[model samples]
Target: MELLNLPGNIIETVVRMLVNQRKTEEIKIRRLNFVQCLEDVLNLRATCVRLLEIVNNTRLKFPCVVNFSWKDPELNFDLHCFINFMANDTNWRFETVRFRKTLFHVEETNSGLLSIMQKNASLFAKSVARLNFDLPLGSNSIVLNVLNLLDWLRRESLKAGGQISFCIKDPFFSNWEAVLLVDHLSIRGSLRRQFDIFIHLVGSQKFPNLSQLDLPDIIFPVAKLCLFRNLHALSICNLELPENEHIPLHSTQITALLLSYAELESDEVECFSNVLCQCFPRLVYLSFKNTYRTTFSDDDNLCLPETCTTVETYSHMLFYFKKCQSIRYFNLQDYYPALDRKIFVKQLLTTLGTRTALMSVRFCGKELTRTDFMSAVENIVEECHSLDVLSVDCCLLDTQDSLNDQTEIDLSKIVRGEKILPIDGQESEAMLKLKDLCRDKQLKLLIMGKTVLYKSTADVRLMGEINKLEDLYKWNLKRGCVQWLSLEN
Candidate 1:
């Protein structure tokens, strides 16, 4: 009460504390399926508060996100003086400035988007270190406007020593581009023109610090991957790599690479792996998501979907992973095994068993059953003594069952020398089984689904924390393994 009654200046400090506390509480509540908007992650402070504090007090300078608006209000001070102050305020920089237009299905044009960017690009150039351009899926493609905006952004944002992350999302879909937007490709050259602009933005020397690119399904059939100078991380989704690949020389500074929903063949796995190694020589983290397609065939007058992973292709995948020695963290999602359980077990161990340098491996899939997955991992633990961290995420694939089944093994007795863990009312039977089996092994268990204890022993602990999503998936910095950052961004 006293703090609220104090002067507004004193109240601002309290507001920051309140914001931090709220974040902690939010994380605690949403333990699993932590849904969030990663892009334009507006800093805790509001734009007005941030700019006011920084302009008045330089120590408070922090990155601020501002949405572009044509009819912008004038501040109390002179615009020229404010910009000049920012020029001298070298330490102060913004995280990103977002430029968004209309939503999907709305009859809006890029004119407003361009209008705001044209007017405000230079005003906050010094403080804007990054740009998050969120655009809607419009029927008409404004290639020239977008190109001009990118060109202007290249000139302005480069001065601020920053880059841009572009995202094109629609109202209806989570990420189904071909199903909806592909029809807008009637004008053949428009798509190519957009690609040209994007490629130019990546390869251009004008924006030397241009880094962190996200070209999701909106820009598929990309002709080539350009060399991103000074780029530390890159993300791409829904791209169909050309059969005839053209990989750039490993002249990049990128450390993290993510490819989602990329259609790749087993025969091409070796070539693609080499291409990745060549393009990002210093890469330490790599992730591939939803790459396995559930192919459906007409079987007995029914279109049945295939459940297993492509054997020859995945076998090649294992072979290719060997070349990526630099990858410390690797994530494979929706890669259901196509081979028989026996052969799949052999392949899993042969590919992942000997890798001594890999610090983390996260497997999230929908198609693999609990039994096959557990057995394969058990072999992995048997073969590899050095590997420590293994995580599984099966949110998309399976149905939950009750824990009342009496045949359920009591793993805690064997692994931890403790009694069986008591199941909460809502606890999934699958996860409980995994914890029961995997607790005793030397390897640290961080699983998202039910799988084998993987070692000779089992584990079980009746702890409330273990059942929560936050506990199973610890978001620690040193042991951080986030594969869905690009999806949210």
Candidate 2:
């Protein structure tokens, strides 16, 4: 056989093809490290060109996740440019580009971004599966950019026969930023027309495929409640209902719900109860932080019957507790007034009674004395048999001083089936009654104080008694505040 001599260009082309074929196969077999490979490719101009061509030709698909690293600016820029190029290339049929980074930097803008996206709208509309946008913590025209990007995507999703998933990152706010986020995203009033157009383009049909959503600190009711029929996990903050306004009770396919700064007024509570009872039959995890400003009023027509009277308000939350039978973890925070706290604890136990599925419970409050705190623990041990992790914090009183004096008062008698006589002061009477109830029930108790001043010898003594009768844990109130307890076992 005669050896055939090949041209230099042809030999070079064949070698390049062999190398890319090996890399592509490695990617397919999961043998190539994506980060290392991308880094190496980015470092070489030749490799970068080859990788870009390979990416364009093969159109690889990847999962989208939120990224928030200031160190990977070059990678972010590269990815953004690549996405824009693919979106603008009418000849390319790339579908399903995973967007990383939930927080978008407003300072990073290219005029070519929109025009390219608009030019390739048809192709993008046909292929994109998940779109993740990051809204960084800056006051720039990021919202407008998001609106423009969304508009283009919406138009494309309409022409295409596939669903799209959208996610946004929200930062904490003290003033109107939260409100602005809501107003910008919510499809209400005359803006409803524009929203309806958007809904038709991307909402009604595409939203059913949404599986995970995260809105860490923004509250937009209209946007939140609209397209979550198939949502599995959601994180939100500052969820509140307006006075005299009624939120319709609707169920979504949500399994985990995390809410912060939730303001559930009397009426909204009822509406929520009705919806939760009937709609979220499969919900398993629910967490909420009730804002400090929430209050109960007798004239509030939407207030549940249990909340109609001052006595009832104490246990009113119980009325809605039974509805969430599938819940495994429950967290409540910043709930106030000693009476409300006591009622809430009692009702929670009664509502969750003997439910073996519960794994954790956390409650934070202010102004709770040692007596009231111990009673709450006993109630939980007696009533909620499934609790594995329990936390309770008193916000107003000193824990150390209170615990020390409290221990000297004889708690083992109370915990070991012995009743204590009531004292004359109103506060003392409440404390004595709680102790008596715990003694009668023979329950384990855990107490925590929120200030170092609260972590005195008295607290240590009280904690000792609690350990004697059952199990007891005490946290120094002053050192770390609320986060220390959260971090502990």
Candidate 3:
């Protein structure tokens, strides 16, 4: 083969080929690094595509986490290309794919990206098992994008026999177009058809292998309760009944239910209580925050049949407490600040007392005196004998003096499980006695105060005493305190 002398151009061509190969290698390396930088910025989808492209071109095996960010134009383009390539390529096999914390923001009302997603829906449904569908708070266009993506995913999963865990953050922010999209899929004529779609997706045997469903801050109508069977966890926010409507008890197989901003009429509390007790019998964790108006009949002094049951008064919460006895963890937010603290505490104690399985309690509210707070703690400690964790952020002891500076308020010693001496002549002994009780119980006390004087261990005995001193000096040095605090646990 080397009999004839090679031409000068032929030699140059071989040299040029070698140089171009090196340049291609360098380019691939640079592109890979760039994709990694994007991943560091939480741009996973782009990184995946870029890596995939490099791998396909060079036959190189690269292992990296794929994160998707909707904000980057190049990243979005790369993602769309990657999806198209994956759909066409049969050799690519992903060990794991995660779509975590990617907030979608569509610039226009119509989402062209959704059509691309729908076109390659099977590849995405097969590759991705964990997906987080978080959209910007007010982006109506993103909702349509989500609905289209979800609908495509649902259809694809049904055909492929694959399961997906989907999380929707703030579903109520969706615009009319998104709502209509859900309605169209649900085949239900009502505007509130998304709930039906969600239930249908959850309950359908066609997609029986679906594992996790997270719906944050979404209110479900009464008809949608049956769709939650076999779910591992369900988080609902702003749970409310339509006016003049009542939901009966229906059992679900969900393990966890986070109920926030439960808007129910006073008369409807009993019905709500019954529904909770009967429906979510297997629920292990239950969380609730805030309340709505209660409907009370004036003439008969009873609940209207169309409204919630007549258990709307504060006394009715006890009924809920009794019904939710099987729940292991309860996080409650007090709705009524003006109600008698002693009476409320007593009712709570009586209701939760029967639940020996209770393990944790989180209480948040205002207008709770130190005594009132202690009473509630004691009630939980006594009733939920198995309780391991207790978090309380309730305001203790109302002060009449309106000091312009909140720093002038003497709260340091009081919060550090220290005995608060009466600044005035009234009830000094009671304060001292309460301190002794807190110390005896080994309660972790967190007090927000202006000045906190360091005390020796010999002075007081408590499990954890965290005093957040709000004075100027403390505020300046607060960073150090925060660092120390972070290191403590």
Candidate 4:
């Protein structure tokens, strides 16, 4: 019998199975074949009115957590229909619900649409364990509607111990008290006035559960530090540190910190380092990333001179490594002048040598020559006893040879000892020595070269880590650096 002649219940079951089957084999050929077959079946839906009605009317149920991003232009089905399907039940669960500006098209607030959205929000509040909701940025009318809907969602989610992450671009919310419900806040203001206004409005208010903050291109909130007693992660990019004011100390709860494109006077670097050691004594992850003046435009006066990031910066930054003694992962990507790469790396290795908890260390710099990197690895092998992983950017080698003809080298073949990469004399010498050191020390060495190279205990571990990184960071083997702490042995 033709599929169109099937009974209504059978057709409904097929439609629901097609929409809700979340598990699939990861093999490329199998994934492609499954996608093609699914596409053909979906296309057949357009030819049959019954199938379309069943798809729109089916009460879909997802067994696993759902991640719905409403702005995807490639979405094959109508999002409004899916939202209605989700709202059909009051117990639909979700992992993340990201609503971007393109998700909505109405110029003015429609009470009917807003009411439907709020119903979905109520369902999300009860079922979603964690909420990383990014508000839609658009016209004032729609923005207000989304904010009000999210406010209701936040209040209900908070009752169930759910966390909310807000990336605020505009500070003109009707209710400032709504911030008290936020658990993670990211302030994205391009202008200084906007940043100041946001701080002025919310800085003094206490957040009982706010634990993660991202303040980019803004000044440090000196007074508000005490308000967030549970802050665990902070990312400050392109921020100017206060010159003479004494930065207060935070509790030993902060574990992850990122300081990128930071501006500070030559004299303040040391004091800031001392303050960080005292503030976050249990720091487990630290990242220091800076680009020298060469990358800055001529009109960019904010670029600190090469002298600002001298040996003093390294000494001061390394002070935290020595004092904390709890760092597990460290990443440094910077261009330095007036400081020898060898000396800088030697000091870093020496400081981390005694850190028994250190698991991964990554270094990225164009100025670091092959010889300098080899020497750094030798020092790490001699010093760091508990270190399990070492990652380095191959751009530091200054080699003109390409390891693979194609853009993607088969990492599975490399891990299986079935592939060999040809290298230049100087590069090969350093890499061979580096590999020998890692092998002897029983460590995993990851080279972010033409492609990534690493030894995995099994093919599953490498594939799993790759998939996880790709899903979270949109990372691939050809990308910049891998977060080794996310790797499983």
Candidate 5:
């Protein structure tokens, strides 16, 4: 009855049967725990010679989705696992196969994953796209040694007419690799020393292809904006940028800028306005919340009105936004709770006047009009010529009228050129207004978070929009997915 002593074929047969059994509804919940089943397989792989052979025969089959973690130094990936991954069937899911680790194993053998990746460099270089690394500070020294492998993969990927999305989820400037090897880097955590290194790398054009830079922890110095030459998207959440200084950027490739929880000082509004006008001419998507350089209260009700008082602050922000004529989407996420809807409507017209290039307006979990929001819709159609998409989190808007407000949306209908009509007594005034706008603008509407919950799964709607099914499949399959989208219509 010792499983490890069994022959390779026998082990494979048993494992297959067990996997099948665990998948069944009869056994999924009560019969076998998931962790225990995985543990059983891991033990089998480590202790049994047979199971490794079985892995070899199967062409080293790997799931399209990969999520590997290193909890401790003892965990290892042997030669078998590395060889298995090199199987010609290596296609990965574009949903960011994450490799995260905290502790660095210093026994000179190198961490199991690094060893495997190094050993199988040629095989891995040809496969991966969209690599996201979220390693802790302690792993910096170990990661430094593997810089050559990363650089090789990056260089090879570019030569194949493909770009590697190397994401670094921390601020660790151990050397120049922090900026040199990353496409998407989030400057965060214990960044006192790392900050200076980051400035040096960026200021010196270390990573010419770095497209996205996110800073949630540091109140970054305003002068650093000029450092990024190829940045396409920048996100700075909850930090206050100094006002009275007109910071300029060197990159026209910049597209999306998200500062959801940013605090705007009174004097800083004009400075931002100037930057919006002068620095970002090709800006496409912009998101910001109105917070006058102060923190909100713990009480929900008390926090909102204080932020909404800054009507003039938002007006200037909108005025500056006029220079960003190429913008396609705008998002305002719960920054204003109570405001005179008339002023908001007028300001919308004034700022967005005749700039019809916008495609979507997403009010994510924000409070909109309670009564007649349709007033803005008429102006949007007349002025903003190409507006088609309007997504709002209508759950927050409260009205005394017994209008049946929508709770969920069907993405199937939205993509199919069909209209989503409101249910009887369920249609709020805002919904009715949006319906009119959709009719006039010929728009596609979605209730936020309802349509395509994860951005990775957003291909569901686009699949229907594509001219042929085969083409869609061929396209997504390259990224390691097969039938991830439900097509059982």
Candidate 6:
């Protein structure tokens, strides 16, 4: 009521401030708080007649697309308020809508809820609608509701010239016709016995516009890869290749490939690499990681050799990139074979140097002394001429006191934890030296360790790469070169 007594300009400013508090540009609203949002707006409008006039005239934008979850089906009926509000406000533009999670346990009495949701879906037919289902295969009425909703959303999305994307598990694979409509599809669980049928469908032109794929566990043959002619990016966690004399050539549209825990026989390494190179000729980004043991028990340690306990060097793993000359970004992690640090580094540098176009490289699972690690950095800088970014995931052990002061210390000869001393100022200075070297060569270095993490200061762009996009992939690190580093000019 105090606002009514204020000057006209002041009252108008207050109203504008309150409305602008919720910005109209690209707002995201979760499902649970939909009612509260409307209540808050209506409360403000009900405060006074002048406020009601201003609120009615001013466009209060809601989320373009409405999202509903099965967690609270009853609340879905309340969604009509928001939709009705959007309907009245012709100035509000509806964009895309996405519905996710399993749909279960809708009583027969609440069957009108599906109709209400379907009517809403029909309004947004010219926009994208993504539906992700993780449901059990059963004759439940709820599943029928979900399928019916998906049918409307998918049909509307297509009519709008937008594609529907799905993240479905094994059970939903039965709906092959619906699956074919997906532009971006991620198969969560194993395909199991249906893998062959899935492969056959893929080769038979089932997924015509499929662009992005994430296959968690499967025995996807190298020959069938060509079936995904429109794929742009692919993530495969576990893959087993069948013995095939002939390999199919894949379309060169795929640009990103991520592989984790894909075990390969030593003989099959080169063949696989050759097939991969032959298949995806345009692939510029690659990530390969194995399940290297992070922690070990004393009982298990007794059975393993000291060399085996350290980082295992799959020197032959270099064959993968050797086959692909177009790769610009490569990430290798946790593949182990018992080999000395120096030998592995030498093999890595030699193999990587041949990939003249490679711009960024990240590797984990190898342990190195500080001296050896610095030496490897120097070698990579000198040999890999085209490389602009390098990231090392392993912690380096300093053999001696790495302090800057050149004073005599008896602790140098003291043995602690296999004669490897904890990193000190010396390692930081060494990193600074490498940083300077990389800076001179126009390179960026990202070394993962407590010392580096705390000592090194990252620039705005580098920090964004480390913080924002790290979680997007299974591997946590920047994929390509950083434009800038926080280095003293």
Candidate 2 regions exceeding 4 Å error are 1-133, 137-201, 204-209, 214-229, 234-252, 257-274, 277-281, 288-316, 322-328, 337-341, 344-351, 356-372, 391-489
lDDT (Cα, 0-100) at 427 in candidate 2:
46
Candidate 6's error at 369, in angstroms? 8.8
Please write out the lDDT profile of model 2 over residues 4-24, one tens digit for every residue.
254434434543444333333
Tens digit of per-residue lDDT, candidate 4, span 1-489: 397788878876876555432212112121112233235345756776777666545544332212233333354245555556456632334434443332433432244434544556654555544444444443565555556656665665434666676666655444555456677887665535665555554455556677888876655644455445578877776434445566555444666666665554455556556555565555544555543322222222222211121111222244333434444444433334344434345555666556532232233343434455456556766566665444333333232222122132332333333323442236545555656666655455454432344556425654454444333322223233222321233
Better of 3 and 5 by TM-score: 5
Measured by TM-score, how close is model 2 to the native structure? 0.37
For residue 259, give model 1's deviation from the true position in Å: 3.5
lDDT (C-alpha, whole model) for all candidates:
0.39, 0.40, 0.39, 0.47, 0.43, 0.49
What clash pairs does model 5 have?
91-480, 92-479, 92-480, 404-425, 404-426, 404-427, 405-426
Model 2 residue 423 lDDT score: 35
lDDT of 3 by residue, 171-278 (tens): 452243333312111111222445655455445543344334444536765456666455555555644553554545456775545554555555666556555556
Tens-digit lDDT track of model 5 for 1-489: 486676767777765544333223122122222333343345555665656556434322121222333323234333244345444433211212244443334543255545655554545544454455455553556566446445554554223434444334554465555346567776566665577876786777788878888776666565566778688877776434444454433334566666645565444555555455445556644555554433222221111111111111232235334444444443332223343333335545555544433222322113333233234344554455554333333333233221233233333332333445332222344444444554544333322323321123234554343212122111111111111222111
Best by TM-score: 4
For model 2, what is the alpha-carbon lDDT of residue 395? Answer: 39
Rate residue 328 of model 5 by lDDT. 40
What TM-score, to 2 decimals, does candidate 5 have? 0.53
What global local distance difference test value does model 3 have?
0.39
Ten consecutive residues with minimal summed lDDT in candidate 5?
A: 301-310
TM-score between candidate 6 and the true structure: 0.54
